[model samples]
Target: MIVENKEFHSRICVDALENAKSVFSPLSSEEKQLLLEQMIAHEFKKGEVIYRVGEKPDGVLYLVHGKAKIAKAGIGGREQIVRMAGVHSFIGYRALFAEEESYASATTLEETFLVQLPFETVVSVIRSNSDFALALLKSFATDLRFAENRTVTLTQKHIRGRLAESLLLLHKEYGVGDDEQTLQVLLSREDVAKFSNMTPSNAIRTLSAFAQEGVIALEGRAIKILNIDELERISRLG
Candidate 1:
């Protein structure tokens, strides 16, 4: 859930800016301040749609806190998750740069906070700053590489491999909780299936199999890694 404290919101927004050092570092102090002034903070509840396919990109959305799932629907209304993004990243920017409608949808995986910078302001700043433009280009390249890798994984991997890789990916993204074993982000079976590109029933069965094999433990929505080596081996085997 989003904290209601305005002070906390402002603090995290600053933190998010700090975390994005590569992007903001290129700007002059005055330019940074000007861009910060134009930012507007927004909070979204779990499962809320941040943006949808066919929507015109109005601004670049910076995720300040919590997680979001980016996905595209396929035939028969199935969802194929493109990726999950957390704090200290920008969303909806590719569409904004392309001057086209969003090609995919972004939804809040949990209560999330974001700061939106106007598209016009972003364009203006990029036009004025070569460093910032180069940084954005690098970000786009990174995402494109990730998309290419995911395409290979989904097409070549078996169900066991796919789910194992997904688990490893989630751990890489959200990390572990204070227990250092339980996953920080709690995803429902359906969400996991969508992210893994499998049917919900198959996802559930595979998760149960993992538990039975002593690779993981499930307690409600929490998943604890019991055998990291084994899980990684399964992921790599595919």
Candidate 2:
């Protein structure tokens, strides 16, 4: 559900840009203001595809609220979840910088808000602001490292370890709910399977097994970690 683009001065749009200050912290006040003035804000409903694979990016997207997943379509139309983006995260910039079509799609996990800095503006900043360019390079490096680590984990880890690590990864990204136990992000079993690199049925059975082992408690889509230490141990052993 994409909303009509809003002016930067609109309250919601302003708030969204406020949440993304860290990304522009390297810019001077005037440059930051100019960038924000040129940004366009968009809202997407849960399950909406933000961008599809092979689409050309027009701008760099900054996730201001809610969650999103970056995924690539696999065999039989299955999607492999490559990365999860939360508030203050950037998406679509890699393709923009590389001048290539998006290799993966981005979808909203919940009602999401984002601000897009135009491609020309971003390129201008990168050329003029040395610190900003370096910061983006560092961010790229960090993402590469995480992808390399996840590739190893998904390929080599057993089912139990994979599931456990996926849950931990969710916790790290979204933190706990009000009870400080239930995961804040609610995902379907299939989404979990994609993220963990397993079949949906296998993910279900392993989740049930973990519940039986007193490592986690499940209520609908909410997964509560009952024993963090045990969960970590299983992930480590694999």
Model 2 weakest lDDT span, ten residues long: 1-10
Q: Provide TM-scores for the models.
A: 0.92, 0.93
Tens digits of per-residue lDDT, candidate 1, 49-103, equal 9999999987888888889999999998788888988766778888888889999
Give the best candidate by TM-score: 2
RMSD of 2: 2.0
Model 2, TM vs. native: 0.93
Instruction: Compute the lDDT of residue 233 as modeled in candidate 2.
Output: 97
Evaluated against the true structure, the overall lDDT of model 1 is 0.86
Candidate 2 per-residue C-alpha lDDT over 18-129 given as tens digits, one digit per residue, 9 for 90 to 100: 5444566677777777786787778888999999999999788888888999999989988899999888778988888899999999999999888787889888988999
Q: lDDT for every model?
A: 0.86, 0.86
